[model samples]
Target: MIKEVGIIGLGNVGKVLATFLKANGMLYWAVSRSAADDENILRNISDIKELPSLIIIAVADKYISAVSEKLAHKFGKELEGVFVFHLSGALSRNELILCENNGAIIASAHPFQTFFVTGNYENVFVDVLEGISWGIDCKAEYFPEIEKFINKLLGKAKYLSSETLAKKAIYHASAVAVSNYLTAAITLAKKMANLADIEAEDFLLPIIKTTIKNNFSDVDFPITGPIARCDLAVVKEHLENLSVKPHLQKSYAFFGAALLELIKDEKIMSEEQIKQLEAILLQKHLY
Candidate 1:
C-alpha cells in the first residue's frame, strides 16, 4: 500500500534509488540537508509538502538515528501507517524504533552491491539492483509490503529477525572480507608482481576472473595448487621464500592451515601427508 515514496539523503545509494523511482514514474519526494550538485540527481527539496506513505532514510549510518529522531519529532504527530526505512547494511531497525512509537512502521533494506558515487548513475540505478539480494530487517507485520517493494526493484529480500540484527557486526564482517579484503588481497598481489616487473591487469586479472567464475559455477571445482596436490616440498619452499614478506607470509600460513582442514575432510591427502604439511605450516620454530 506504499503509494507515495520520500527519499532522504542524496548519497550514492540514495541517488540511485531516487533515480530509479523517478525513471519508473513512481510518485516520490526527496529531502537532503545539502543541495544536489550531481547532474544525475534531481533537485532535492528541504521538506515534504504531504508526508509520504513510505519514507526511505538513506543517510550515513551515524546519522540514521539522529535523522530518524528528527523525523519522528517533526511529523510523528500526524504520521500514521507510514513506513520508515534506511539503507544501511550494518544498522538495526531498532535505530528507528522511535518511529514505531509514533504510529509508524520501521524497516531497513540493505543492497548487497557496492555503490561508487562517481560511476554511471543510470547503470548503477538499473543494473545493480536487478535480481540482487537485499538484507531486510523489519517488523514481521511490515515484511510483506517490504518484500513487495523489493520485488518491484527486482531484488530478493532475506528477512532477518531482531536476534539476527544483533549479529549485524559479524554479518558485515563477512561482507568486508569478500569485498574489501578481496581488494586488499589484489593490491598485495599487484605489489608483489611489481617486484617482478609484471602488471597485475596483464598477468593476474584473467586468472582472478577465471578463479572467481569457477568458484561461483562449479561446486565440485577441484582446487589446483601445491596444497591440493599435497606437494609438501613446494609449500615449504613458498613458506620459506614468503617469510621475507611478513604480510604475505602470515596470509599464506593462515589460509594454508584452513586448506589443510578442507583437504583432510575430503580425504584427498593421506593422514601422514596432511601431518607433514601441517608441521611445515605451523613453523613452531617461528613462535
Candidate 2:
C-alpha cells in the first residue's frame, strides 16, 4: 500500500534513489539542506504540505538520527505509524528510536553496494541494485513493508540478527576493507605503474579480472605468486623494491603476512621454506 515516498538526503545514495524512483513512475518527494546544489531535490520540508507514508533518511550515518529527529519534530503528529528508515550499513535500528517515539515505525535498509551520483540512471537500478544483498535491521513484522520497498529497486533483504547488529562496526570494517580499501589499493598500484612508465589498464586489469574470477571458483586455490610457490628469493626481491615506498611497504607486509598464513595452512610450502619466507617479510631492508 506504499504510495508516496520522501527522501531526506540528496547525497550519492539519495540522488541515485531519487533518479530511479522518478524513472520508475513512482511518486516521490526529496529534500536536502543543499537542495540548491542538486537538481534531484524537490524542496525542503518547510515547503512540503503533505508528507509521504514512507520516509527514507538516506543521509550519512552520523546525521541520520539528527535528521530523523528534526523530521519527527516537524511531522510527528501528522505522520503517525508511517515507516521511516535510513540507509547506513554500520548503524542499527536503535538510532531511529527518536522518530519511532514520535509515532513512526523506524527501520534501516542498507544496500550492500556502492553508489555514485551519475546523471543518468535509466538502467542503473537494474544494473547495480538488482540482486544486491541488503542488510535490513527491523522487527519481523516490518519485513513485508521493507521488502516491498526493496523490490522497487530489485534488491533482496536479509534481516540482520541482533548478533550481527551488535558487531556492526566489525561488519562495516569488512565492507570498507573490500570496497573502499580495494579502491585505495588500486590507486596505489596505478601510481606505482606510472612510476615504471606503464599503463595500469594494460598491465593490471587483466590479471585483476583473472584473480577475481579464480577467487569465485576456488577461494583456497586462488592464490598464485611467490608466496604460494614458496619462492623466498622472489619475495625478498619484492620486499627490497617495496622498501622505497613506506606506505606500499606496510601494505605488502601486512597482507603478505596474512597470505603466508593461508599458504602455511594449505601446506603449500615446506616448513623450512615457510620460515624463510616469514623471516624475509620480517627483515629490515632500506631502499
Candidate 3:
C-alpha cells in the first residue's frame, strides 16, 4: 500500500531505483550531495517540502550511518512513522539504528546484483533486475512491503533472520568471491592467453559460458579442469610456465590448491592423486 518513496543518494543504485520507481508509477523524490541538471533529483534532503512514507538510503556502506544520522536530525520526530532502508549487502539494520531511535522503521534490503553503470543510464533497462534475488533483513511485519517493492522492480525477496543478517560479512564475502574474484580470475586468464598470442574472449568465452551454465545446472559437482581430472603432469607444466610471472604463478597455485581441497572428498581422484596434486600446488617454489 506504500506509494510515496524518497531516495537519499543518486549513485548507480539510486539512479536505477529512481528509474524503476518512476516507471512503476510510484511517487518519489531523490536527492544527492551535489547539484544536478535533473529536476527530479533535488540538491539536498531539506529541499523537499513534503516527506515520503518510505526513504531508501542508497549511499555507499561507509556513509549509511552518517546519512541515517542526518535524516534523524533533519526530520526529527516527523520520521516517526516513516520506513527507512539501506541497500548494503554487508551491513545489517543496525546501520540505520539512529533513524530507528528517532522513530523510523528501519531495514536492510540488498539486491544480489551488481551495478556498474557508466555514462548515460537511460539505456540501462529495468529488465536487468528481472528474476534477480534480493537479500532482505528486516522484521517479519515489514516483509510484505519490501516484497511488494522488489516485485514491482521484477525481483524476488529472500528474507534473512536477525542471526543470519548479523553474519552479513561472511554472506557478502561469498558474493565478492563469486563476482569480484571471478572477474580477477578471468583477467588473469586473459593475461595468460596474451602470452599464447590468442584473444582471451575468443578462446575462453564459449567454455566459460558452458562451464558456468553447467555449474548452475548442477551445483553439487560441476568442476572440470586439469585439477579436477587429477592430471598431475598438466598441472606441473602450468606451474612451470607461470614461473616467469610470480604473481600469476602464486594466484594459480593458491586457487589450484583450493580446488584440490574442494575435490578431495570426491571419488574422481584417488587419495594418492589428491596428495600429489596438493604437494605440487603447495610447493614453495610455486610461491
Candidate 4:
C-alpha cells in the first residue's frame, strides 16, 4: 500500500535501490547533495520534511542517527502514518527512535547485494547472494503492515523481532563477510597469481566462476588451496610469505582456523593435521 517513497543518500546502495524502485513502477523521490547527477528518478526533493509516505534513509551509519532525528523533528506532526526506513545492514530499529516517536512507521530494509560502479545490472546478484531484511526494535503489532508489505513487494524478506535485532546483526554480518570478504580474498589471489609469473586474469576464469557456482548450490568446503588439503608444509610456506602483510596474515589465519575446524567435522582432516594448522595460525597471533 505504501506507494510513494523518498530515498536519501544517493551512494551505491541508494542509487541501486532507486533504480529498482523506478523500474518496478514505484513513485519515488530521491534526495542527495548531488541529486542533479541523475535527472530521471521520480522526483528529487531538497528537503527531508517534504519526504513522501516512505522515507528510505540510505546514508552512512554515523549519519543515520542524527539525520533520522532531524527528519523526525521536521516532520513530526506530518508523519502521522508515513513509513521511514533505513538501509543499514548493522543498525537495529531502536536507533530509529526519532521516527517511531513522531508516529512514523520505522524499520530497516537491507538488500544483500554489492555495488558495481560499472554500468551493468543483469545477474549481478542472482543466487550467489541473498537478501536478508529485518525491522527495528519495536513491537510487531506496531508495524505489521510494513512487514507484510515488505514480504509481498521486496526480495525474500525474513522478519526478525525487535528484541532479536542483535541476533539479526550477526546474521547480517555473516552475509557481508561472505560477500565482501570473499571479494577481498579473490583480489589477493589474483595478485598472488601475478607474482608467481602467471597472468593474473588468465587462470582466474574457471576458479572464480566455479567458486560462485559451488556457493550457489551448497556451502561446500573450499577444495583448491593448501587449507583444503591440510597441506601443512604449503600452509607454513604461505604463512612465511604473508609475514610482510601482518593484517592480512592475521585475517587469513583466523578464517583458516575456522575453515579448518569446519572440514575436520566431516573427517577430511585428521585431528593431528588440524592442530598443525592451528599451531601455524597461533604463530601469527590469530588464536
Candidate 5:
C-alpha cells in the first residue's frame, strides 16, 4: 500500500531502486548531490518540498548518518510517522537515529543481490526484485509495515534483530564472502586460464555455472575439488605450478585454508590428512 518513496542517492542501487519504483507505478522523488541530466532527480535535499511516506537513504555507508542528519535538519519533525530506511546490509537502524529521534520509523533494509547499472534504464528489469530476500533490521513494532512493503516487491523479508550488532555484522559478512569473494575467485581462475592460452570464458563459464547450480541444489556437501577429495598430492602440485605467480598462489592458499576449515567438520578426511593438508596450505613459503 506504500505509494510514494523518496530516494536520496543515484548510484547503482539507487538508480535500480528508482527505476523499479517508477516501473511499478509508484511515485518517487530521487535526490542526488551530484549534477545529473535527469529532470526527475533533484540535486539537493533542501529542494524536496514534501516528504514522501517512505524515504530510502540509498547513499554509501559513510554518508548514511550524515544524510539522515541532513534530512532531520531539513524536514525537522515533518518526518514523524514516515518510514525512513537505508539499503545497508551491515549497518542497523541506528545509522538513522537522527531521523528516529524526530519520530521517523527507521529501519535498514538490504536487498540480498548485487546491482549494476549496465546500460539503458529501460533494460533495467524491475523483476530483479522478485523473489529475492531482503535483510531487514528494525523494531518489532515497525516490522509488519516493512514486511508488507517488501511483499509488494515480491521479496521475502528476513527480520534481523536490531538489538544484536553481531548478527547484522555476520549477515553482511556472509553476503560479502559469497558475492564479492566469489567474484575475486572467478577473476583469479580466469587469469590462470588466460596464462595457459585458453579462452577463459569458454573453459570456465560452463563449469562455474554448474558448480553454482550444484552448490544450491546439493546443500549437504556441494564442494568438489582436490581439497574436497583430500588429494594432498594434487594440491601440492597445484601450489608448485602456481609458484611462478606467488600472488595467485597466496590467494589459492588462503582460499584453500578457508575451504578446509569449512569442510573440516564434515569428516571428509582423516585428522592426519587434514593436518597434512593444513600444513601444506600454511607453509610460510606460500605467504
Candidate 6:
C-alpha cells in the first residue's frame, strides 16, 4: 500500500503527477533543492531521509546519479525497503542500482505521455495508456503496487526486464520522436508556410490540430500533401524553392525520401515514381 507518494523534484512533471496521485486519495510529499518556498506545499523539503513507500525522482539526469548515491547511504538504514523510481526516458535502471543494493526496490515508471500545465491534458492519459508501455526493473514485490497505482489512476503499466532494455529505449525514443521531432518538423513546416507569405502563426492552428488528430488516429497510413499524391512536379518545385534555406535542403530531401519509401511500401506509388523522386532528390544533392 503506497500510502505516501514522495517526489524528489517538483517541476511540471512532478507537480502534475503529485496532483493525480493526491486526487486518488494518496499522501503527496516532495523535495526540491532549488525550489522556492512558495512553490507548492509538497515541495521545499530538500532531504529524502524519512522517505515514503514509492519515492519518485524527477530531477535532471546529472543529479540522478548523485541522488542515487545519497540513497545508497540509507542502505541498512531507515530508507531500506523503499520503492525507488524515476521518470527519465534515456537512463537505465542501473543508474539507481545502488539504491537496489541498499535493499530499496528500483524501477522507472515513466508515463509514455507529454506534460503540459494547462489545456485538456488530464484526459491525454485516457486512451494513451490502454496498450501504452511503462517501465520497471526490480524484484517482484514493487510491481503489483506500481501496476495498481498506474491502473487505478489513469493508465496501464508494462513491466520491463533487463532483456527488454532495447525495446524500452526504442519506445522512449518513439515518444520523443512524436513530441520533440514532431515539433521540430512542424516548426520547419511553419517556416515553409512563412515562405508562402502566410505570416500569422495562428493561421496554422486548424492545420496543426487536424494534423495531430490524423497522427493519433491514422498512424502509418496518414499521408497528405503532394508527396502522398505522387506529385513529383510539386516536389521538384519544392526542391528548387528550398535554395532559400540551404541548411534545410538536406533535411527536406531526407524527409521526401522517407515519405516516398513509405508510399511505395504501401503500394501507393510505382517504381517509376520512386525513381523520379529519387532522381530529383539526387539532383538537389543535399548530401
TM-score of each: 0.77, 0.86, 0.89, 0.75, 0.90, 0.77
Q: Write the per-residue lDDT of candidate 4 for residues 35-145, one digit (tens) a residue.
A: 665554433233443557788888888888987777776777587678878877788766788878888787777666656556464334343223435434445665566
Top candidate, metric TM-score: 5
lDDT of 6 at 202: 74
For lDDT, the strongest prediction is 5
Residue pairs with colliding backbones in model 1 are: none
lDDT of each: 0.79, 0.79, 0.84, 0.69, 0.86, 0.72
Off by over 4 Å in 5: 161-166
C-alpha lDDT (0 to 100) for residue 284 of candidate 4: 34
Worst 10 residues of 6 by lDDT: 39-48
- Global CA lDDT computed for model 5: 0.86
Full-model lDDT, candidate 4: 0.69
Writing each residue's lDDT as its tens digit, candidate 2 over 244-280 gives 7877876777667777887777876788987887787
Against the correct fold, how does model 3 do in TM-score? Answer: 0.89
lDDT tens per residue, model 5, 1-287: 35689899988888887877888777478998784677888999988999888999888999999999999999889989999989998888899999999999999999998785566866756556778899888888788889999887678998875454567778788889888999989998997897778999999999999988988894877888888888889999998899888999999899999888877877677888789899999998877
Q: What TM-score does candidate 1 reach?
A: 0.77
User: Clash totals for all models, in order?
Assistant: 0, 0, 0, 2, 0, 0
